[model samples]
Target chain A: MGETVIALAGNPNVGKSTVFNGLTGMKQHTGNWAGKTVANASGHFKSGKRSYTLVDIPGTYSLTAHSPEEEIARNFICFDKPDGVVVVCDATCLERNMNLVLQTLEITENVVVCINLMDEAKKKGIDINLALISERLGVPVVGTHARKKKSLAALVDAIDGLPHGKEVCRTDYPREIEEAVKIIEKKIPEDCEVSRRWLALRLLDGDLSFKSEIFEREGKALNHLQIRRAVSEAKMYLDKSGIPAENVGKIIASRLVEKAHEICDGAVTGETGYYKTDRRIDKIMTGRITAFPVMLLMLAAIFWLTVKGANYPSQLLSDFLFGLQDDLSGILTKLNAPSWLHDCIVFGVYRVLAWVISVMLPPMAIFFPLFTLLEDSGFLPRIAYNLDRPFSLCNACGKQALTMCMGFGCNAVGVTGCRIIDSPRERLLAVLTNSLVPCNGKFPTLILLISIFFAGSLFSSLTSALILTAVIVMGVLATFFATKLLSETLLKGKSSSFILELPPYRRPQLAKTLVRSVFDRTLFVLGRAAAVAAPAGLVIWLAANITVGGATLLQHCSDFLDPFAKLMGLDGVILTAFILGFPANEIVLPIILMAYGAMGTLPDLGSTAEIGTALAANGWTKATAVCVILFSLMHFPCSTTLITVKKETGSLKYTLVAAILPTLMGIIACVIAAEVMRVTGFC
Target chain B: MNEYISLNQIKKGEAVTAVRVSGSSSTVRRLTDMGLVENSIIECVGRSPTGDPAAYLISGAVIAIRSADAQNIKVRRRENG
Candidate 1:
């Protein structure tokens, strides 16, 4: 037999990707707990002697083309015509998932229903009769706990055992609707890849996407005007039969749901006890009085753990990595290496790499897993559920709340996560505002500034945590304000409504989640930062060392930027460091220290007090520190995030806006702050 | 004659049967696809503290719908209790 192509189809949160991973053994990051998968990923696996290629499409509630994900799934199934489609359903919620299964059956004849998450169902006292369901639906059905390899073998066997050229049992619409579809079916070209009845039903239900899809597939062979005429005739006939024009789709949907109910009545039995536990948890987590406080406390705890926990490890890594620098310098001296080469390699590139890794790795190691834990445990959607009203008030979708949480981890990832929002305008608003939240790279700088400048000797940790939390809260509030402003002016539109499903809260697989996050997110992000930091370090070293007219190039650049930087309550070196730190935010302080010429290498200031002394010697004051913090929180994203924004939006216009928006906000904020402090004599 | 009320009017823990799921075609279809068809048993599970989007238990799924969207789904209190 030839290679069989099987498309994995399902509603969101159905463990479809788990089944794919089980069969293919490829780790494609599954959807967020809310069931939003942005991209289509494919993997190849072998079942017996026949090789099977599996395409993982984005999950959607229906194939009506209300959203982009739904459109992609619909078009791929209609046009690509995979050999057999595997419709995976969550055993606990078979009826809700069966809607997509019936829709897929309409599009293709070959299908096998893989009931996934059987263990979760069994634990919840839910029993699904697989053979009964298969007999009723007239399709092959297999049960599997997708997370375990042993259980998926049966599903693999079912895939290879699918029969071809059999009659497909499709959902039976009402008599009048079936007659309308019959009329429209005769108009569809016979040579089309999709089934004529499916096209007829979609067209009569007022879905025009298939027309364009057919045109794209078959150029000018099908008459568009004839199809439009036939669709109008079908709608008029339905209206004449006492059904309202707009209610055609509703009538069709209800009929399909009735079929689903009939099949579910005989094939499924469950107590639904799991929902009580989920609801009890939701009551407290989303309780109005408790929700805001719980969110705040969670935020504070994560940051506290990150800040306090990362300090010792950061110090250890710094000591270990920098300790090697001395040994390398000793070898260079003994071998009589050139001084410039020694300075460039050791002081420039190597020091920046050490600094970036030591600072970035520790916090990322703590933050990503915590974020993933929330995501996996499904609390992230509840957070979205709580924040939806506020986001709706701002004329944006509520899913922006989840995307904003992603921003707290890394702005680039957050920007990409905007795909969760189905509306274009709101997604753009999210992409533009994501960088307001400080990412892992900016955390160290913000924490250092808060510690040395705001927190004194007594109660240092507490004061630092409180101030950092306040800064984050301010960034979040700023994001809301900017989203509102952008919506009211640049992207004026009504907020699109969504049916946000609060998936049953499940016990997070902590060990697997941590392992996946560490490899997929933390290491991946750290690798990107290191890639840029090395070259950036070389440039910084050259600019500092290269003399031009009795002053190094770094001195000349800083002198040139001094007047403007001073006007904004900063020195030329701070502005120059920020400009250089575009490659990676982790290297900003090292660049500043290098420019100060306090030592030939990045300094190891032991305590906040020592760091304060060094900055005080460099003409820093309280006003400067405050401006620096504000600037750090509001500056352009690092080079990696900018490139990501470019790639995600695919528009230079928005990418430029993403870069300029935050910098302008930072400059305006810093200027206003400086003016206020200067006039009030507060600093 | 039977009294009909929209889903938004139902109190928490009150059971009702859907009489009509109405809205734009897409919204109505989405509601039905979520198993909100006529005669399906539904109960108001809980309301968010702000109380705009309320969770409803329909066909064993807890779906949160805003008040505006919930207004489109009409229901009647269960009888013969």
Candidate 2:
């Protein structure tokens, strides 16, 4: 009555989220699913006089409750009772997509089949007769190019017209199954709202969820014992007919496939011959001997481009911004402005912005676009394929490796990506171990430490990059080891089988990749860092300038945290900054600068050696630097990650574990590093 | 002869039927969800470019079950093969 509730459901990478964002603009959280962290999304839109709420259900292949996403999707549709459901399907893969559509039809028939990416289908020379599909399915089927909003108006009109539409005749399953379903229909209680045919099919397939649900709904009158007896009777009858429960599903699927093929026989046509390019390329890319090397080379190229291309721009931006700050300070002094205003503007705002732009922005700008390019090119799936075995060896889902790889970009995003792991236990394992992968934020700390200490005497800046790469490799190794250890111990479970579809390599749309990377990832990071950095800058300025008992506020806080920091192989200042940096990692460096500034003035990045000198002056040794870097790499996630974890798990206990586990690991690693250094006299 | 067939050794187009699932619950659930059951038909789609394990098409979805997981799952070659 108030607003139309429209649920969007589809398989992964079917552009459901893209469709949601296209409809709602850039005002939606495109993270993991709410509560379950299963990649569910919901957004709102207004069309004409009616407001519509679109719930993006997790992308699932079927409604058989194979994974958490599938279960959540099935439950939401059945229980939540939405007004209308939009089932988005891939236009190019209609046969496979119809499996889900047919399953949805078995449930409530208040549905619209939206065949999206018609343009891609067209490019592949595949044509669809929407009329025939509608006729076969007995539902409204709208063909759309969701990315371009093509036929979006038609979709809106369809939604509005749903209430007035006639009851379309639904498709029928096999006659034998249909007959069995009819008999079962009469046995089910009249008050049960779910379609009898659907329940019959589920029962025939031995679907545990349906059996449990029916048992629970029936309560004491039909207990589990009775339910099990009934199921066994049904199984006996089914087996006597020479058809097993599992065979029923296969028969149904194959029948649907046959129908889909019949409908598509003449409706669609494509090039009969395979492309030489695909074969030629696949020969090398999928080659047994060359694949690993090629993958490594490709990854190295991407990282090299990111690091090399980012340096000059990063330096330039820092100089320009910091120079503007000095000019603004002089102008304010000339205007006889208050010292507080000067400190807030110059030291607080400018310094923080400088650090953000100089450190966070450039790498992100270079990295995200390249990452997007690889993703668009369909290369990331190969990375998952490559790492699958190693992951399986650790008794974890192969998809966990993919999630960890994503964490190298951002932990929150990585944690969100764990939705791909179908098993609840494996998904949780992936989420917990994600923090072990150092993100872009941690890269700056790694680079600085490695550059100053490890690569200072022996090699050039290139060697510094290599050392940084080695650190990343180490972090990945840690992630694998941690995942293995956790899967074998704390969260013991069998790993889920994941089918990583290595999509055909295509030329990535540079424009789309660039825009999305810049807007979605780069700007998102910049905006969050800037928001926290400004206030943090102000706080740090006040702490530094406002001294208490001849000791700054920072010093007091650091002194308080000193004992714990020492035990963990770090000093008070470093530990205090890490604590304060819980909100955003970009703020950690700025906070450290402020802490040092409280003690004595330090020069900017113009003279790199000056920063090293200042650190040495402040009693920081190579051992301390190494400890700080390791701690930064392994420490608890920022506020964003914690919030994501809470949202994903929907349990304070799980969120606390996600937070504390990493922090504990970080502390232990730092302690070991410090003690080893101390005993070896490396400091 | 009870010759073992690891998933890694499965060639493209080879058909096998699952006899049992011998993995952890998570792995078992995942495999079962992928339509792997006591008697599900599976055809090896292809090997990874590196060939450590093969990709198989089962129940319409493509899954890369590792050699270890595959070794645990006993399979009899389809009679047609």
- RMSDs, each prediction? 2.5, 5.0
Candidate 2 per-residue C-alpha lDDT over A100-125 given as tens digits, one digit per residue, 9 for 90 to 100: 77777777777888888788778777
Going through the candidates in order, their DockQ values are 0.64, 0.29
Per-candidate count of clashing residue pairs (backbone under 3 Å): 0, 4
For each of the candidates, what fraction of the native contacts does it recover? 0.59, 0.30
- Write candidate 1's Cα lDDT for A1-683 as tens digits: 66789898888787777788889988765554554566677999997658988999878777787655677777777788888899988888888788888888888878999998899899888999998988877888899988788998888888888764556667988899998998888888897667888888877777656556767786565677887788889888988999877788778888888888888886899764337689789889889799888888888887777777777787788779888888988998888989889888888888888888887888789888887787777788788888888888888877788888888878887887787676779889989999999887888888777878888752366677778888999898888888898899888998866567778887767887788788888898889888988998899889988888998888999999999998888899999999999988878887887788543456665344666777888988889999999999898998878998998789999899888888988999989998999999977
Estimate the TM-score of every prediction: 0.94, 0.82
Model 2 residue pairs with clashes? A33-A39, A33-A40, A286-B49, A494-B27
